[model samples]
Target: MTQAAIQVRDLCFQWPTGASVLQFCSLDVPKGEFWMLLGTNGSGKSTLLRLLAGLLQPQSGEIKISGQVGFVFQNPDHQLVMPTVGADVAFGLVEEKLSLAQIQARVHEALTAVNLQLLQRRPIYALSGGQKQRIAIAGAIARQCEILLLDEPTALLDPDTQLDLVAQVRNLVKSRGLTALWVTHRFDELNYCDGAFLLEQGRVVDRGAPEHLKQRLMQ
Candidate 1:
């Protein structure tokens, strides 16, 4: 069996209002796999991602992630802070204390991995929605995160752009051997996922291959 990149055992969480938001007996994301998390609004998809990213702590049980996490929000505007593509990608590395040359190399490599090296100097405000998404991904790549936590990243994109963004993410994941937990409500997007889990009221109700889940859901 493949080693688990992320493991959650008996995890539980609640809002400040004391209302439970998530309760998972166990969950696993295998190394180098693309897993889609499907649910409607208030299903706790975003909350789960936050927990995995260490933005929130579980009230009970254990959560184990093997390596660093890079999070991408649904809106690119929320993730981006710098004025230009290159600067934005480098922003995450500034605190690493690496030499200037090392930072530049990493930024260049990350941009190239996303096929956006040419646009490194482009202004963030001038980018198309799809391009901004790519830039956001490049920042994650630059961080060299072992696992990526994406919270409904394609929610704001057009259908065609959404598909393109998924393809780009698929290529990058395969080449980098990174584990990704992506949250989305679009059933069609499951075509890009290796497997998927259905979340209902903060509980995992179903798990299987993406095609199998899609067929079952349709039926």
Candidate 2:
């Protein structure tokens, strides 16, 4: 069996208001696998992603994740801090104390992975919404993260852009052998996923191949 990239057991989380968000028996993401987290509004999709990203502490249970984790938010604007694509991609690496040449090399490799190398010096404001999201992915790649957590990353894009971004992200993740947990409510998006976990009120109700889950929903 493939080694697990992310593992959770008896995981539980509650909001400050004493409302529970996640109460799961167990969850696991095997290395190099892609799983879609499907849930409706108020179903804790984003909450789960946040917990996986270590943004919030769980009230109880355990979360074991391997390697570095990178988060790509629903809004690319939230991740882009610098003026240009190259600057934004390298923003997180500034504190790593690496030489300028090393940083440049990492930045180039990441942008090239996302097919954005030519736009490295382009202004962030000049890029389209889809391009902005790709830049966010590039930033994560530059960080050399082994796992990626995406919380409805395509929610704000147009239909065409959404499809394009999803396809690009799927390809990047597969090619890099990175594990990803993508949260989305759009059923059609599952076409680009390998497997899926369905959530309701923070509980995993079902999980299987994306096509299988879609058939179950239809029935």
Candidate 3:
């Protein structure tokens, strides 16, 4: 639809030990829309995101992604490399060949967008789980990413904080016109997505209204 921001067509991937991870799986995430992928453990959900992010190579099929891509992991500790929040966020821009002033502006804008400007100078270890997620997302924004891929970003947060992080991501998608595809198993999180895809056995068996998928999974 409207030239998807993230397009996966007939993707196929397998491990070196002859274990199939994904097979003929395909999906399209329209530009500026927020979508979620739901699947049980070992359904290849995280593997698919990694493929789209170019972290893994596919055995077959094609993946077309428009604009810069930003990836957020389930654990912030896996990606945040800098000691301070601002440094971590700014770390993403190291290869951009930007001047100090330009990098500072980007860091400020990104932190402000995530409502983390006040904690920009705080040590990374001093932040809470939710704040850590915000910092990770801010790092993506600092790079001016147009497409965001998140792998169960709320997995470590409390119930309320989980919802808060999802809501915050939804706001970022709408406000910044960024396309986001998030991987999640939590049914309640479906309420925030424009659509949802149900993956089973490494393939998409259901895709449509989030509520419909949520209800089907419940029943």
Q: Write the per-residue lDDT of candidate 3 for residues 128-208, one digit (tens) a residue.
A: 999999999999999999999999999999999999999999999999999999999998999999999988988899999
Q: What is the C-alpha RMSD of each candidate to the true structure, in Å?
A: 1.0, 1.1, 0.7
lDDT of each: 0.88, 0.88, 0.94
Ranking by lDDT: 3, 2, 1
**Candidate 1 — which residues are off by over 4 angstroms?**
none
Residues 16-128, candidate 2, lDDT per residue (tens digit)? Answer: 99999888636788889888988788988888778888899998888899989989999988889999999999997977889999999999999999899999999999999
TM-score for all models, in order of appearance: 0.97, 0.97, 0.98
Ranking by TM-score: 3, 1, 2
Q: What lDDT, from 0 to 1, does candidate 3 have? A: 0.94
Q: Tally clashes: model 1.
A: 0
lDDT-better candidate, 2 vs 3: 3
Off by over 4 Å in 3: none
Residue pairs in collision within model 3: none
Predicted structure with the largest TM-score when compared to the true one: 3
